[model samples]
Target: MGGPDVLATWSTGEHTGAALDGKSLTFPTYRKGTGPGVIVIHEIPGLTPQVVAFAEEVVAAGFTVVLPHLFGTPGKGLSPASLATAFRQVCVRREFTKLATGTTSPVAGWLRSLARDLHDELGGPGVGALGMCFTGGFALAMMVEDTTVAPVLCQPSVPFAVTPGRSRDLGLSPADLDRVKERAAGGCQVLGLQFAKDPMTGRRFDTLERELGEAFLRVDFPGMKHGTVTIDRQQEGVDRVLGFFAEKLH
Candidate 1:
């Protein structure tokens, strides 16, 4: 744990054959630390140095952090080419819903299952889920399962923000949105972070506020930056996420 640029070696594991509706997905996962489990879902360019650095911060804060390799090359730093390639892949994959509104990305089901298994194994109040950039809204969608007690969305950027309507979309189907509302009412708190003028995030925070009311805790900084906890690396945003996890998961 030297720093964000220099990280400790991760204990690798594979989520072999994890499926939803008969659609199976297998990817490499990285784990470290010891405490309540927190699943750190990476953003568009995959698990870049910044993303892993943030996860290491979580580990240092005393929680077991599991990072799943969704796309891009692990350990590779973020770059324009990497971002373009990952975004293109997400668009082509059936697992993600890029421009569609009111639909949960099919990949969310697999992530929910992963959350459930982690919570079951760790056994506590529940697990914390933090999804960044392209996968940000996933934490909310993962709330469909009881195991995801603390959901953090840092610059969610889903449904691709291609249109005004899509920008406002939370990337949850109507049914899943209702489930999330119910979970919020039942005491689940969702933490969202974004730059105040980040176009990629659109008005999804407004949607979260409208739907979840006080349960949607948001941290909007003053800028046009998108990746609040990753490439942008806002220290306050990182501290806020760690604090939110501490209050909810511990």
Candidate 2:
């Protein structure tokens, strides 16, 4: 795969699909693998090769993977310009909650609906959800619903951390947070990965520890690398996510 700056050819082969939300939000999705369902939400710069590579890993681990294009152009590489462009789009889009605290992105409801549909189709005990960067905390929100059995949050930076409250917020409403906490306490282990030096994550991991207790399995990296699991690919993080899905979904 090429770097984020390079434009990669987009495809719509066997793995191509879309999730329609009330005739409004048509989430263009890609899928691969077979077995349990795993919804991998892309970061700010969209479903780049790095993100797809990570999803391919999930598929290889004996699970079906769905990659959603939330922000940027699919197959576009991540670069400074791409990041800025996608970030800007997120800011202006009504579907995404860009600069607020304790509020789920409007698109999350659509994602939750999509997960349930997938679970019904896949017919497993439940499904796995991995959301990175701008979509990271999305998995946590999905846990409030029943179908998401495995929720892995990798450097889930959202709401921009523009304020003190948002820096520690999970980007969930109070009711949603309570539901997620309840599920975590009920033995639903939530996995999280972050670079110790990444300021974008703020104190969200700490908040996770406080809310979910031992159920929040946090894996922290050593540097300021933003996307610990993808663009800044870390095999350890990848293995952890895949293992968690295997343990929880299968």
Candidate 3:
């Protein structure tokens, strides 16, 4: 988990907590000069130092940033070691249908609720959601509640898991996708980012981008791997995100 200094302390305020999904969600929040609300959803590895640094960068751009610990509390954060191991196992476990089918899980509901709470706290009509990796599509799901909830689905997964029973759980129901399309037609933009080498996100980015049309802003970082966006906040993608939020939310 060690890496370069991607964040300056002055960029953000402090880390805080909120109750969500029966867990004490620890978030690295920044609220200095207010403009728009931004909710940062962490990858499967949970809210690591890298992710918090990215949230800080967002705050520096003049937005209220909330990095929710969708997994759990601070120290209880997901272990990178274990996550890496699990990812490896998934790669080898050919019978891991559970992993794919688990896409229709209830995680999206919790995220949507948190977005609502953040909107309430920020005193805005709605807020923006940024989801990465495992939770990437959650942002899109949040938009199902309202089009005003601009979402950035960074490296979304589980596209082939679409089914009637698991649709709502996995953040892809017919009605929800239809609503998102409608929003896009009306002018809501959904952005996505992925490393060119990350097979998990790269494969579906183009397809989803095509399906989403003008609403989808797809960016690829050549030679970069999975989880690099947060790992390298100084990168152009990160900067674009900051600027995008500053412009859209403000």
Candidate 4:
């Protein structure tokens, strides 16, 4: 609130210029620490200081952390202008599947490719992925691949939920949903967090409960907080993610 650079002071971790070059897409990635692998997906506002701080926490917890600059400026703080810019970009971006159901975001492929590359390089119990806000449901979609051992969804708000049917959508295709269900049945677990009052999330968590049953662990925060993990800086939610990564990726 003081200055744009005020949030810059909270910056930690290193960019290292590491990237994953899929055939079509290329992500300008950031990396830090040295241990098993963990991919921390930023929300619609992109890689802000709070998000970077969360990644740094993962690094300090002893894991190699990779944060792709999906959109927005890295190290930038939340401001009216920044949020407006990001929202405009997201609305027009072809990669994000908004106002649609039973479909996965095209960007999920790039993230999946990133996960594969990270696993190949880091090499451990597989890789942990934590998707926040716009990228939230992406963790679930990415789980269709075997390399993503741990997937966390924090306030996933995708597909817009503009209609009644879309309100219950978690932004996964039929096939991807089936695969995630199978993985859940096979003892794979997922962690999800959201606020009951978050209009952006709608009834997506309810869908997850129905689809994942016992395998999905829903950490519901009842209040006005919409961005659970990073934007609002919920310590408990952050700690839960770190603990989940330790248990799965360690």
Candidate 5:
């Protein structure tokens, strides 16, 4: 199916100084109604048109959505090489490995702060998070605090280590996993979505479900491909995601 049209657009500003590591991180936000807060973390390609559109859909659902431009400003899209370079840059400056391990990374902290600010601004006690592709596991890490996080992992990446010692490269660390397990045991529910054929996220789903037990809820779209689920669009998988989030966060 085709993606939805751009519903609306609003200007979001850039961050200066050490907070943004001297790079400008600015992104546009498309909103609808307002109530709870939901943070949408984009894929490695950065915030694409589809990603922003998804945020718009969340807004339509009566939740205020924020899509942070972890990469940088809009217009210039990153090629594969540039993408890798950007990620490495973020890693070197932000120590992303530490963030994945349950300690907040620079970007993760920004997300948490944004969520909290949005929750307060929107007048809610909690908020939801959605992470995709390279960011999928980050949402899980955001849930460690629980006070502001209710997360949805869509096609999460970086969980299954390709080589020895690679597990450390995942966004959620062992300590974070332990915390997630504890939270799950105590009644928190963590949901995941993936395409059955998407090799990148398929293994992650298996690993996380086994590790998270009942706290993990996974929905596999038998014929869907990666990036198929966009915001406010109608698709079986998208419907399932909305339903899942509605049940868990609404």
Candidate 6:
């Protein structure tokens, strides 16, 4: 976690908490900006400064952004220690399906609820959803809800990629996959970003290409960077995501 202290300047915005399934799911969330809503899910090390900076970028792009603090220290920077701490929490947390194949992380239900609430309040076609790193495939899973119009997956690394089967898994169950496929076929487009050689992302991108066909917008960079919109950010990737949100939501 050796990085600039960008968090000091990060806007606190409107902080609140959300719950679903009575008390089965709950997480603190921060919101800012105004217009079409977008949920920016943070990576493995939790809501690090880079993630916050990226969220601010989304906010500046003229969209309302809601950031759910899933784990780790919100203002902390990325480091080996921070990553390990968050990884442990992910493994122990029932809300996440880290190494489970053909399973949609249980937290997605709460996220879908958040998306629905945002859409209901904003009264738009739908809200945009973007998940990075460990939560990457979440944006795709969130698409099961019609409230998610624009879905962006940035190097979705889950199910750990310890085996071939895990590598190809989209971190979603069969039923959810069917719904996502139907949505794709019915004109919902999914955008995915990853480094061409990133092992963490494994074959999930290929799986997405096959499943969604032309509706899957693929953006691959040349190096092995994992976080496309945060840590090892690419300006083009960020621009593409903002453009996508504008097209689908506005």
Per residue, candidate 5 scores C-alpha lDDT tens digits across 153-180 of 8876553445433343446546666877
- Which residue window of length 10 is worst by lDDT in model 3? 94-103
lDDT of 4 at 169: 94
Put down candidate 6 lDDT per residue, 41-150, tens digits, no spaces. 99988888889889889889999988888888877888889989998898887888888899988888888888888888998899999998889988988999899999
Better of 1 and 4 by TM-score: 1
Better of 2 and 4 by TM-score: 2
Candidate 2: tens digits of C-alpha lDDT, residues 1-69: 455332232223222222222335666666677999999998878888888778777878899887766
Where does candidate 5 stray beyond 4 Å?
1-8, 14-32, 72-95, 98-106, 159-161, 164-170, 228-234
TM-score, one value per model: 0.95, 0.91, 0.72, 0.90, 0.75, 0.92
**Residue 181 local lDDT, model 4:** 96
User: How would you encode candidate 4's per-residue C-alpha lDDT over 1-250 as one tens digit per residue?
Assistant: 3233523433343332221223365567777789999889998777877787777888899998888777887677778888898989888977777878899888888888888888988888799999988889999988998999999999988877677688889898898899999999998899999987888888988998999999999998878688786777788888998899999988
Where's the lowest-lDDT run of ten residues in candidate 5?
Answer: 14-23
In candidate 2, which residue pairs get closer than 3 Å at backbone N, Cα or C atoms, i.e. clash? 4-77, 4-78
lDDT against true structure, model 6: 0.87
Evaluate residue 167 in candidate 1 and report its C-alpha lDDT on the 0 to 100 scale.
88
Better of 1 and 3 by TM-score: 1
Better by TM-score, candidate 6 or 2: 6
lDDT of 5 at 11: 47
State which candidate, 3 or 4, has the greater lDDT: 4
Q: What is the lDDT of residue 95 in candidate 4?
A: 78
Cα RMSD, each candidate: 2.3, 3.3, 6.4, 3.6, 4.9, 2.5
What ordering of candidates by TM-score runs from best to worst? 1, 6, 2, 4, 5, 3
* Model 5, CA-based lDDT: 0.62
Candidate 4 pairs with clashing backbones: 99-159
Candidate 6 regions with alpha-carbon error over 4 angstroms = 1-23
Off by over 4 Å in 1: 1-8, 17-20
